[model samples]
Target: MQWRGRRQSSNVEDRRGGGGMFGGSGRMGGPMRIPVRGAGGGLGITGIIILLIAAWIFGINPLELLSGGGSLGGGGGQTQSRTVDTKASDEMTQFVSTVLAETEDTWNGIFQAEGQTYKEPRMVLFSRQVQSACGTASSASGPFYCPNDQRVYLDTTFFQQLDQQFGASGDFAQAYVIAHEVGHHVQNLTGILPRFNQMRQSMSPEEANRMSVRVELQADCFAGVWAHFTDQKGLLESGDVEEALNAATQIGDDTLQKRSQGYVVPDSFNHGTSAQRRTWFQRGVQNGRLSDCDTFNNPV
Candidate 1:
């Protein structure tokens, strides 16, 4: 993806070693997991690793995946947190910081063009567990953005799992993950996330899940929007777009569910289907316009 020699963001909060509050007891979960409600949850390192191993050996089971915790969502979660002084992998840290800086550049330009001021969001790099405004999360919780705090929480080890377990690799794929979370931050700044959450509160579970799908798909499109700018700046290589599309396909709710289980349950999907994900992402990449990312008003 040609990310080397790029500017790194200074907003990164590194809490890797064992010096922070949750120090002694928090470094448990290894595989990333994002809770559905972004509330209280805990997965021992042994338990989460077992789940990941089971999925690796068996198949990527969505049911088993959500069984331990839940799907990713936003809200105020009970905060149980800690941090360490140890730095993260130097290479990974540099790569993420670069990505964040690039996104800031892209979004800043976009917002300015729209006659709005862009508020940059911070990214928090943590290891096993860290507390967020949404709640405390383990590595198993996966990477997520907490709108309440306007920060993106990430666990770098998840990149390994993305390659080895999810069959999604490449630097661009990793960037897509970061971009998608940052996309949520964009939504938060634009007041989309808060309004959507308000609407979700009055809907049925199925309805809320559908809304969640649109929200996530929009974030995917936002990632593509960022990709469009990167491509325009000649930063994208030949296969970079494909890497991101493959990642979007692999992480689709239906794809994950089918891999984990033998069948599909449409109702349980919080994220869009594989085709839908790829399509929405392509929409943004093709147009590079925010109007094209209206997953809620237009057909996804």
Candidate 2:
């Protein structure tokens, strides 16, 4: 990806080596057990059922309730911190910062063209666990963007998992991960996320999951848009685009579910299938237009 010596983002907050208690715990179960690319922590089936009942009785958005009230806090109690190789961690940090800076440049120009101010979101680099406005999350939650705090939380170790576990190895694949989370931040700013959260309050779990697939696919498309511009800047090397496509395919809900459990539940999918993800991403890459990335209004 030729990212070295690039401008690193100032919005990066290094929280590595910081010890914290594991506050929020529960897996949002499906065959896809890895970290998702959106806001909030995992909610088990029990948690979902409880939240749905509570939301129905109180007429509140479940997502808002999941994100606890009050300012964001760091962990309150001590836990054993994960050991990280300092030099390797530093290099990974630089790589993420550079990728983030590139996304900023791409989005800033696009927003300017539309006569809107682009508020760049911060990226929090954590080791084992970190506290967010949504809740406390461990590295197992993967990389997620919390709309409550408008920051993207990432664990560098996930990059290794993407390569070794998912077989989506490449620098561009890593960049796609960061860009996808940042795309969620863009959705937050554009009011798309807020509307989805509000509307999902009344939706059945299946219906909500359907809508979620669209939301996630849109983010994937937005990531592709960023890539289009990045490529225009001559930053993309040979096979870069293919790397991102492979990453998208590797993380598709259907693919993950099949790999993890040897089956698939179409109704349980929040993220799109591999083909859907790749199609939407390619649509964006082909045109670099936000109009082309409309997964909600169009048949995705």
Model 2 scores a C-alpha lDDT of: 0.73
- Residue 65, candidate 2: C-alpha displacement in angstroms: 23
Which 10-residue window of candidate 1 scores lowest in summed lDDT?
24-33
Off by over 4 Å in 1: 18-89
- TM-score for candidate 1, please give it: 0.78
Clashes of 2: 1
Model 1 Cα lDDT, one tens digit per residue, 235-289 = 9998999999988888887778777776778987887888998998898899777
Q: Against the unseen true structure, what C-alpha lDDT does each candidate score?
A: 0.70, 0.73
Cα lDDT tens digits, model 2, 1-300, are 989988888787777767366676332211112344321221234224433443454456666534432212222222233333334557888888889999999988876665556778888788898876666788877888776667787878999999998899999999998998888777666555655665676788999889888888888998999999999999999999999999999988888888888888899888889899889888878878776766765687
RMSD of 1: 12.9
